[model samples]
Target chain A: MVERTEKRHTEKMKKKQAAHDKIMAGKTAEKGLLIVHTGKGKGKTTAALGMVVRAIGHGKKVGVVQFVKGAMATGEKAVFDAFPGNIEFKPMGEGFTWDTQDRARDIAVARGAWDEVKRMIEDPSYDMVLADELNIVLRYDYLPLEEVLPVLTGRAPMKHVIVTGRNAPEALVAEADLVTEMTLVKHPFREQGVKAQPGIEY
Target chain B: MVERTEKRHTEKMKKKQAAHDKIMAGKTAEKGLLIVHTGKGKGKTTAALGMVVRAIGHGKKVGVVQFVKGAMATGEKAVFDAFPGNIEFKPMGEGFTWDTQDRARDIAVARGAWDEVKRMIEDPSYDMVLADELNIVLRYDYLPLEEVLPVLTGRAPMKHVIVTGRNAPEALVAEADLVTEMTLVKHPFREQGVKAQPGIEY
Candidate 1:
């Protein structure tokens, strides 16, 4: 019985290895990518920050532009600020939609943030650029797709870009190399009556 | 026309502020939580690491146990290693399931990792504990639910715990204070024929 079980496991392992090797063999080409994190769940921006940390660990510089969360300083921002030479953080948003009810002003601020992104993209010093909540503005049509899409797709050949928010534009999704939708399965605020905490949420 | 727009914006801001204040009034309770990141997306573990970075920034000690990723040194591990006194990382997995075909051995290793987790939970020194990929082992029944759920629910009242992986158990989900399901809208490996890159995917 033991011998039969061992033989079956060996055969299974060999088959799985062959499949993985075949798929990995065709995946050798490398280039900078456009990644999107969207949907009605948490962790979109948090995941982008994770990439920033990874890039910094590799001795690469990172740039972050917060499009709609500039009113308050967050825990993540504090940590990012600590890495002075490695991280460049520009919090440009005035506030949330309800707090800033002027659509025209929101559009103007979005343009300003995009200008910063364009500058960072052209600078070879920044290995990765994170456009935090750029999707929210894009979804609200605060920025023109004709302008945003071209600059993103035409970025330096080896500079990675990450755009994060809830509702990414269809054009951006089509042009992205990777897109993840964070589905809202369960939320503490809704079910367990828990509010966001300092270190974990921010 | 500009004056009218300004007046409308001011009134809207007032209403929004009132609503925010009312919500904030009821959110006075603060406590530790169990946050679960699950589903078929790419950011489960990455999101948890973001919190780790935040906790370390606040001078909070953290304990991380990688359940199924012990074979190699990752970029994140290097970053965690940099914070010698603040972060403790243990990569306890032998490898992925296919790499290790022995179910009995996998169970034993998982038990060993859980022993470390219990110790971390009871110890007051660590502010947060991240059980990376614990859900995968639980999904495979390597660790029984009855044995796992109690420790998770009975942890230190002030110590935060995060469990990340795909296919979280129903019992675990029910017990968790926050749960996020990362849905795979698009993947570079499947859609763009791109392989995982060094600083991004690792």
Candidate 2:
């Protein structure tokens, strides 16, 4: 009975491998991707930062502009600062929307951060640009979508850009080459009154 | 008009900050988290690796065991190798289930990796343990869920264990303190025939 099961499994895997190879063979195109991470869960920014780390590992230069989380100190800032030559990490926001509570100031801050993002995207030296929480500012209309979309879609062909936050606009999703929505399944803060900790949430 | 706006913003922020402080004050519990990153979209392992990087930044020791991606050379492996004192990165699987085609060998490989994970969990020196793609092995029954859950749930009070992959077991989900499901929004591989590139997928 075991011998028969082994034979069946081998045959099934052989067929599956053949199919996988065929699909892989057809994927020949290579270019920079316009990636978006949105939705109500965690890991959107964390995953984008992971890509930043990967780029750094490959000796590629990266630019990071945080749009909505500049009031507090983050562990990423301290870590990325260690690689001054490879990464230009900028946390440009004053705080969250509720904390700021000033529309004009929020718009000014978003514009400054967006301007930095535009510079990084335009510069050929940066291999990857992470617009951290850009979607949040966009969602709040602190920055105009009309101006932002053009610069993103018209970026250099070989430069990757990552935009992260919740409630990404439909138009941005339509334009992005890759998009992932993080759905919150369970949260300790909501259910068990646990606070966010260092080396985890930051 | 500008002065009025500023005045209103200041008052609103003051009230918001007080409320925020109260909420934070209630959250005094500090303990390790059982985090699960699962779903059909991208960034499951990527985000987990980001957390690993964060832990490293904080000078914490970490153990990473890859369960189903040993065949390919990954950028993360090369990167994590630079921090020998901090990260013990191990990719143990021969390949994916379809690539291996042997259930017995798969199970043995998974058991070996799980043993490593258990060791890391029990060791006091390790601050965080990442079971990368363990969910895939669990889904395939290469490792018994009954044996895995106890080691994970009963881990040390301050040791963080991160499990990443798609289709996490329902029981595992129930036990996780933080769970994020990466949902597929748009994929270039399916629509534009773009292959996974270095610094992005690996």
- Scored by TM-score, the top model is 2
Please give the CA lDDT of all the candidate structures.
0.84, 0.89
Give lDDT tens digits, candidate 1, residues A109-130. 9999989998998899999999
Per-residue lDDT tens digits for candidate 1, residues B1-202, read 9788777866776798789867766775667889999999899988888888888877789999989988435667656666678888888898887677777787899999999988998899999999999999998788998998899999888789999999999999988888899988788787656778867888
Clashing pairs in 2: none
Model 2: how far is A41 from its true place, Å? 0.5
Q: Kindly list the per-residue Cα lDDT of model 2 for residues A70-167, writing each as its tens digit.
A: 84345565557656788998889988877877778889999999999999999999999999999989987789999999999999998899999999
lDDT of 2 by residue, B1-202 (tens): 8799778877886788889978888887888999999999999988998898888877789999989878434567556766679888888888888998888898999999999999999999999999999999899888889999999999999889999999999999999999999999899998888898888987
Q: Compute DockQ for each candidate against the true complex.
A: 0.57, 0.64
Prediction 2: B-chain TM-score:
0.92
Interface CA RMSD of each prediction in angstroms: 2.3, 2.1
Measured by TM-score, how close is model 1 to the native structure? Answer: 0.92
> Would candidate 1 be rated incorrect, acceptable, medium or high by CAPRI criteria?
medium
